[model samples]
Target: MRCQPRYKGLVYIWLKNKQSCLLCNEPADGTAPICMACETELPWLGDHCETCALPLPAAGLTCGQCLKQPPRFETVIAPWTYGFPVDSLITRFKHSAKWPFGRLLAELLAQFLQHRFDEALERPDALVPVPLALKRLRQRGFNQAAMLARWLGASLDIPCEEQLLKRIHDTSAQQDLKAEARRKNLRNAFALAPDAPIKGRHLALVDDVLTTGATAQALARLLMEAGAARVDVYCLARTPKPGDAT
Candidate 1:
């Protein structure tokens, strides 16, 4: 987690001035291909729950659900709430193979995480992407979480362990399920790779979004049971409670 900043700093400096904004085609103003105006207009997450990163009115407060039944992961870190152009961008990136949009989001997420690392948030020893099932992977051609993880790992200099987890079976798509059904859908859905070096090592799960967190919880619990010291989630965005508009 403790990295020499000069190398990444230089890389970002090069990234900042190299290309036009992907969103507006204007000059990029920061560390990614996004203009200053468009960047500000993105749905940046405000203060939220300490555990799940759920959007909330106040800071330093855990949401009620986490209080009642604690999650296996230590925390969730997401830069934006799922809405607006963020949602549209992720949709296109995931479904339409718009790699640039995904790359742009991943770069910005790396910047957001770098600030957190500077502020002394403990960095994970490795990034473990949430794996897609074989059927879905065959159809999609690529795993969005794996792509995000690789980009983040390259930018942040963290090791990406793409094979640490595997989806054991395919299930109904989570987006179509309610919170309770989401949990049920993920039951027995994942497994740790044999001989994975998880013991006592902090690991972060990388994904595109944190919805009900059912997927994260199942995977994190598996890792923790496998002797992982801690687990955290890193994602592009977090959705508000179901049926709530942000």
Candidate 2:
């Protein structure tokens, strides 16, 4: 006797797609160019420090660095760890101008943030992408943070202000610097726009990645000084502390 094939229904048919995963070239499960298995293996952040979002041994606890000297921002919210394909994706998006990667990252971040907002997280009144120095902007022809902020704001229905903050100093890159030097380098790097109406507003500062968070601290302090009620940091990924493995 021949057995009949089981009918899985229309939902399965609707989800079937011919798209391939961008990372592994496997059949993608959804609109994203990544498959479910690959997505599960991505560097998702877990058990992080509440104050700085640094990878911690457990959740809801502050890191020692944050406890000793708290950053200007109220909290850091990043969805991924800066590892594996996440770092590669960000580098390609930011430095190599791979916009599709950026779009995908932004979409994922937005989805994560939306869920957070639904689950008792307070939404910010506005988003401010960390500004690029004029010289650097001219050289790069675009700001990766701004691009992410625009996509997030559109998705989340928050106002995104690109001109609210200005990068006054074209300082050297922060990638190679120690924590102390990074803070010192960004001391006066950011300034608020003269006419930005940020007073009493809960603002979120958006960026592609949060490493040492020197840049976020500098910008948050500037925004607070300009009368913002609260400042939050939102980034795609957070790097682990130096000498610590993720």
Candidate 3:
């Protein structure tokens, strides 16, 4: 969450020069393999509302909505915003079935969590991916979030239990809905699996992106109600947007 900008700034400086004499082949401007010129521009969450990490009323910590009803997940760390290259990358992996990213993101997410939450992340006993319903899994071919969880857990040497939680309902895409609608759409969407158990465990919930955070909140409540001691959210990106309190 508080990282001193790294080689990226230097990379950007090289990119702005537009010289054919590039030093590294890293994707020009991104957190990738090309030089700075080729990297996709990423939006950083600066001066954001602390509650939901959304760009605020150009002011304070907690946004008005978070003050009214806070989300259930304890702490969140999303390294980047869900847009441009990151968005397209997620789509490529999530929709186009790029499976290798599963492992790559896992390590990256673990590193970010270590940075963002530090000791807090070290406390989670397990990493659980937000589950996908049966129908969606059949359609999408793979659960990208689940892949991330496994990879992250392996990187941290923590166990990953894929069956701990599940989506019992199939809901419409939250990307297409308003904030209130997204919350309503996700209500009762998740249910704990009968065979899976999580009593007395501190769980780190992993997801690719969090927008309204409705799904994570709902799942966090269910997990606590089922006996989880602590729950932290670890996402690749958190969408920032304007909102009416939901």
Candidate 4:
């Protein structure tokens, strides 16, 4: 039997084609679905850690965590800090299966990444989406990371290797755990897919958000150990330091 789409009706298609600003419901300014005003008002990330994209008070500085224990990934490119309308939109897209919100975010992120590439950020050979555990996939009816990767790949003209990584364990959600616990929870939680062609290839992992960097570290370490030349992270938003507000 053919599988039904996660979103049920023509409304999904309409929303996808809708030219209104998702945040303000006004006509979009240009090709993107969000107008210039709303786009400017979005929580665009400011001076941040050069390596991890963690929001920082000053520019061109590395966070202490990265200074002490470096991560496996080389760089993280996020356009915004997880706050306000971006957080709300992500919640709706991920939990409520609101694909339009996700689509718009992915489109904007694609544009942001392209600009970085033009400015000398090395483009990855392919985009690798952080995998979802089968249980969670079944529960959610879709994997948001995979969706984001595909959208970005199409917009950027890069290949998206959705099957390159596998989530082997159904560990508890990372949000509920502290940073250290988050790391421990991912122990042996991921593995490279069989015959994955990662050796010496530069790859960027795609996801909706980066919180503690635990998940990205684990996945990137696995790929590095398996011979990938480099791994970077590309996500829509990155969360700020745990107690501080963005």
Candidate 5:
């Protein structure tokens, strides 16, 4: 049997029940939590490195760093450069337990991923969020990356595996460390679950932000050692190289 179309009035009422813009408090145009205007004003990563998604002077090219030594992950997909309101939103979401901001960011990232999937990007078999050390998880009461991953997984109908990667060390935070130090700190930091069957699987590592990328690299390396065929990094924002402005 063919289903009848909803009345125009009913559609409008349903739309009204959706969320409004968290930044400007304007009614969102569609499923997004932010209005179109605010979305346009976001620090969109226009031109970036094809491999790392680092902001570049031009698009469709690899950055020198990637050419010198490629990262473990194949490609990075981030919609925004870590700047302005994006950084502020992430800080609040991660530090202050502001779940609404996190949800808004995750919704936007999911939309971007959907577009990529539509445009011939290969979908991953599962999403594994970069795990937090037990100490940090207890301190924060939640893992921000896990929350974002679960939200995106539900939106995109992909499996979210929180226990696929385990953090075995309580390393110092990466924020204040130099790039080399960050890499060193994350070395041997992540371990794959012994019983997880990941052979030949294409996996996407979900995280809130990509800074120096040390965490993602560590996790990706672990997945590769476990016989995973490919690893892709997915995050909301990517920060410019250390000491470089966005």
Candidate 6:
């Protein structure tokens, strides 16, 4: 599947593999690349709060909660809410054993960042993916967040420190906990590198999604305490409060 340039020389290719398309085949004539249908389904985020990245309610300012109490992480940039095609897209890539979408999702994030912060990209820095507990990694077979970080690092030409932050404690599913309870659940769950210092350096903390943000808060605290000059969160999605899943 591919979208010919609006005029010419654009040529979008392989929305996915041809095999996954209704037409069917492995390479599926990527001459254009992503098919027209797949192209339309590409999840994109429009003008949104630069802080939380949550869709603002028409005239509201800073989503109320954020204005009251900003998250510990400096900023969040997510291309889509944790729903629909974005949800299915992540599941396919993480659980269904498909790996290509990881890069696709990272590209979408990069596009969003470029649109919002073209000048910020020139700042050389490190990307540290939220680490997973050894127990969870053993159970799930992969850390989707880490994989997403790797993909983003490659596309953005930034370095992903990969193992700077450590999950000091194994936490239960934060999804089931209340926002306040989530803070307690994730308390002391993370730690900075023993001697590795990111002091006076900018760090982009990557994760698949932001939920109660308790885990993110915990990580931000650790990084700051470890002497990080600043920390910004970059998640793929944000799960709305109550009944939302990412």
* TM-score for each of the candidates: 0.93, 0.91, 0.77, 0.94, 0.92, 0.79
What local lDDT score does residue 2 receive in model 3, on the 0 to 100 scale?
62
Candidate whose TM-score is highest: 4
Give the lDDT of residue 151 in candidate 5: 92
Candidate 2 per-residue lDDT over residues 11-85, each given as its tens digit: 222234555677787887887667889888989999999989999998689999999998889999999999999
Model 3 worst lDDT window (10 residues):
12-21
CA deviation > 4 Å runs, candidate 3? 1-41, 57-60, 101-103, 117-122, 243-246
The digit string of per-residue lDDT tens for model 4 on 1-246 reads 759757443242333444777688798776667889999999999999999999999999999999999999999999999999999999999999989899989999999999999999999999999999999999999999999999999999999999999999999998899999999999999998899998999999999999999999999999999999999999999999988888
Give the backbone clash total of model 4.
0
Q: Which residue pairs come into collision in candidate 2?
A: none
lDDT of 5 at 31: 70
lDDT of 6 by residue, 167-225 (tens): 88999887778888898888888877778767887888898878767787788878877
Query: Least accurate stretch of 10 residues (summed lDDT) in model 6?
Result: 19-28
Across residues 109-214, which tens digit of lDDT does each residue of candidate 1 receive?
9999999999999999999999999999999999999999999999999999999999999999999999999999999999888899999999999999999999
Candidate 1 backbone collisions, by pair:
none
True-structure lDDT of candidate 6: 0.70
At residue 78, candidate 1 shows an lDDT of: 99
lDDT of 1: 0.93
Ranking 1 against 5 by TM-score, winner: 1
Q: Considering TM-score, where higher is better, how would the candidates rank from best to worst?
A: 4, 1, 5, 2, 6, 3
